[model samples]
Target: MGTFSDPTFRDLMAQRPFLRLWAARLAGTSANQMLMVALGWQMYDLTGSAWDLGLIGLYQFVPALTLTLWAGHVVDRHHRGRIVAACLATQCIAAIVLMAASRGHWASRELLLGMSLVFGSVRAFQMTAQQALTPLLVPMNLLQRAMAFSAAGTQVAIIGGPALGGLVFVFGADKVYGLGAALLAVSCILILLLRYTYVALPREPASLATVLAGVRFIWQHKVVLGAVSLDLFAVLLGGAVALLPMFARDILHVGPEGLGLLRAAPAVGAVIVSVVLSRWPLRQHVGRTLLIAVALFGLCMVVFGLSTSFLMSLLALGVSGGADMVNVVIRQTLVQMETPDTMRGRVGAVNSVFIGASNQLGEFESGATAALLGPVGSVVAGGIGTILVAISWRHLFPALAKRDGLQAR
Candidate 1:
């Protein structure tokens, strides 16, 4: 019942601290979007090899996967706001170095990848802390709206960041890097402006046991485990993004412009859905809704795979994006609502790893399957696999399937 036109949305937005946090998310995510574009172009410019282009993802993934547990541990035991600020500061420094490297022609492939590694490392901490901090800023009733609005910001960034990066890159690589640094600096300032305070968990001595606790907690919580793993496997098996280029170039024969549209289609869909969700939140059947959305995502993937027509393909991808946004809001809300503050950092870390796995590993899966089955067959097979995963999850995780809403029990 919370439309943007309604007082609920306006009331939530009017809160000073929450608005500040929202601004920080927008600024930081936009910078992330710009950074990805610039980094990819720089990598390809340095080495024409597509393999190295692929390694940029790998470089980022390795640190996020490896450091996530420790990052969560630090988040719980420390001031989350300070931790986020420090991470942003580190990223600011990295951006400056990258800008200098580009301007001085001091950049090597190794140096670029190393910077990518550093950026990834810092991002793990920043995201974990930020996720944990969000609940602290908004009251329970407004959390769902807050997340939807937050998601809209990300979709906007995803849609615009590449275009912005490309425009700045036209001027100079350093200028692109400078823009990223400046945005990150602004994000850091906004986070500092947030009046929300952190209530840190009691300090505990570092131990292997402490680091592993998040994994254990998730394992024991059936709903959380089910929600997280559902996304993991569904995305892993359903991932058809890596095959889009093949579809655009070979099947659709749309070339570069068509490819750009195809890539943007999902984000466009996501933006629309996110805006709508922020206005008209899903207040009932949260678990079932999530499952339905993901299953539709799988079906859309199949439709996309089979389509030779460009418009049809775009429509299918758009629908898939819309469905995925639903999954994102539902899954994120479930995780946040179910988690205790003491465990939020660890749970967030677990969620982050699942996300990284689904994205990075999913790409690899798509590419390998495409090579084995041809792009169409590979995508179709992945879609089928995703549907199967959804079906199995419904039966396997009945708790998640039966759950009614996002309100904490």
Candidate 2:
């Protein structure tokens, strides 16, 4: 029914789908990371304010939420590979538009925001298809490991892409966008190479009715609702990583390069842990383990907030990233395993909304709170809130602590 986890790197390489998907994810995410940094830097350079930098993240997310549900319905019902390919293709077009704007030629902020809206729309589609499709590409026993591998790829983009982006931006952001477009175009090509349609379950077909059924199903499932709630709260409260530029420049005096490193630190730690997970996979007591990991993640955020030393701050953020990976693997497994096969795409869409709210909203929260409480206080308070969420969630889902990974038939 499944493959063994304890395999050589060569054995892991034998899985063609895994290898292709891995490469595609890496290339796509690298471009995504580079675009994020380039866009933020360009906006900040143009406006010369931390709040403006925050708005860049905000603007991208606001429009994305509007399309998430429809994207999910389409993903669940349609050919995922084609959908993903289309999304990547759309993203490439958006990147080209961004490149034009990077020439410092746009007369109005509305133009930039419009491009961002389109980019976010494509991403909303891409994410829904990608999340739901991954489980189908690998065995149930290997779901967490596969997820861990995907997480590691994201880490590479998150950690390494910025360093590369910093160099590119030092020269010109237009060049960065150009490279990002190239990368995404290449990812679309690779995605076309995958036969994802073969893996999806053939159902009675998808419709608005089926999509609504998925939402009602989620509403009825207490465990899922609770887990989603916990994650949303903890992440929304504790995500201070978005404010790293301010910490690096104003507080620690590292400039852009240092800001890039600070931004990359968490990904570095996540990569280290994720590599281990690819080999070891998640074992028993998965739920309790996730709770503990989230608690530790919260503590690391608190430590990062209090630290003035750049290295110490980086280390703290790294620990948070590492711990958060455990939660990611477990939660994703829970979603994939417990969810009915036909509705995976819709569920993935719901999860994406929570993720967007937590991440993008958290960026806004950091900016607004920083204006009031100062950056350090805002981060520290967020960590405390995350810890409280972990404790509360643990009290609510005692059985989750006793569960184990799924076994496919």
Using all chains and alpha carbons, the TM-scores for the candidates as numbered come to 0.97, 0.87
The 0-to-1 C-alpha lDDT of every candidate, in the order given, reads: 0.89, 0.79
Model 2 / residue 150 / CA error / Å: 0.6
For residues 1-409, write the lDDT of model 1, one tens digit per residue. 5335688888787878878877888888888889889999999999998999988988988998899989999998999988999898898899999999999999889988998899889989999999988899888877888888888898898888888999999998899999999999999998877776666567998699898899999999999999999999888988887888889999999889999999999999998898888788888888888888888999999999999999999999999999999998888888999999899998999899999888988998999988888999888888888888888888999999898877997
Task: List, residue by residue over 37-70, the lDDT tens digit for candidate 2.
Answer: 8877777767777887766666778777878877
Kindly give the stretch of ten consecutive residues in candidate 1 with the minimal lDDT sum. 1-10
Q: Please give the RMSD to the true structure for each candidate, in Å.
A: 1.5, 3.7
- Clashes per prediction? 0, 0
* Best of the candidates, lDDT: 1
TM-score of 1: 0.97
Top TM-score hit: 1
Report the Cα lDDT for residue 319, model 1. Answer: 92
Instruction: Record all residue pairs in model 2 with backbone atoms less than 3 Å apart, i.e. clashing.
Output: none
